[model samples]
Target: MPYLSPADIRSKTFRRKRQGYDPGQVNEFLLIIADALAGRLRLNPDHIRTVRFAAVPNGYDPLSVDGVLHLLEFQVRNGIVPPTGLNSGEDLRARKLPRSGTGYDRAEVDAFIARAAANLDGRGSMTSTEVRNTRFSTTSGLLGKGYQVQAVDTLLDDLEQELRFRGR
Candidate 1:
């Protein structure tokens, strides 16, 4: 069982989307996470799990952020972060994109995720700059169903942060 290092939690950035949790509140909570992970704070897993962030415009994406929080909660309670990368494609592959409207283009998101994972594994050639700056087109009328765009972008942004931190 591998614990999530403070550095790992500290370097993460939540993606902001409309009507998400307030960034300031989330940041403050993340500080607690770091301290707790570093043995400088005492907090129960429920403290992280049940935390409420005030709503504000362009705040942290709720679903994406919740996923991270769940993982953190698991780590704190169980003393082991799961054996998975933050942006692992396995979960993404099993995700069912909402069909009510077009989200991010499916193929593009999948391809980029694969490439990003490969890049981290030293099997792909995308530079950190390229991964940080890469953009994908959106789905259009009847083109295809898609995943949530903000979620995917946030994931990529976090991946970019990881790449840059490693490069340094």
Candidate 2:
């Protein structure tokens, strides 16, 4: 496989989808990744592997984003660009999901994420089934804001997988 360079990352583009990864988030992340590839920023393979973007209407295709991310992760792991620092140790529970005009209730999703993170860390109990079945109330209108539905659902899918791996 050809090694991807900072220029390649910066120049890459994806197809827009009716519902897909948020373009703003993906573009921002791409800039960060490109900088890291150029040794202008410090980021580890784990950061590349675990990165998630919000999903939104008229956004970049998720499959395309995932493919690029997979390649980046593989390249980083293979020493194409040596990582200069350790994981940031940021708490997943503190990470905020992007809000949308019509989406899941932010508070509900936040609470669920906190609970799920605790369960994953062995501080609480939650089942894969629970994660699979979780749902949040939607919010809309001029003043109301909420977490992006597809983004939260994507996170729930990851959490469910982890829970299952842990035999929860």
Candidate 3:
């Protein structure tokens, strides 16, 4: 299941509001919108499971698209199959992502680490608005909340550590 459906997102029904639109009708409409969007997105029954299992959850952030994509790319690069049901031709095609079964070069891995570090370091020195607008994309939703670059970098660090421990 998706984390939240479009209807759940767009629904007008919410906490009670004084002098607000009709709660019942708005909420119902949101649900409809969400369902329609969900259908269009082709969200699978296992989408939530896939995301949740991709990483151990922390209090602030859930696994994000970038994180998941990173993990998937890492797995592919290292020739390690992730510990979940992400292997399918349809899903791969749906994302329109390419996989040539080639691993990252040692130089590329080093460069990736350097880039992640630079991104994290720059975030520490930048203003909130700059970080929010230039660093993280809104497309990530809740996953794109505060300090997304840091989150992704931290995840990359963990992944790299795991890869090293595994003797990748």
TM-score of each: 0.46, 0.46, 0.20
Predicted candidate 1 versus true structure: per-residue lDDT over 26-92, tens digit per residue: 8778878865654445889998888888889988899988888888898788755323344444543
Ranking by TM-score: 2, 1, 3
Quality of model 3 by C-alpha lDDT: 0.31
lDDT of each: 0.67, 0.70, 0.31
Which window of ten consecutive residues has the lowest lDDT sum in model 3?
91-100
Best by lDDT: 2
Regions of candidate 1 where Cα sits further than 4 Å from its true position:
1-3, 81-168
Candidate 3 positional error at 25, Å: 0.7
Q: Model 3 over residues 56-143: C-alpha lDDT tens digits? A: 2222122233333343333333344222121222321232112122322233334444443443333223222232223222222333
lDDT per residue for candidate 2 within 47-118, as digits (tens), equals 988998888999999988898899888876664742212112134565557778789987787777767666
Query: Which residue pairs clash within candidate 2?
Result: none
Q: Is candidate 1 or candidate 2 better by lDDT?
A: 2
- Give the lDDT of residue 143 in candidate 1: 48
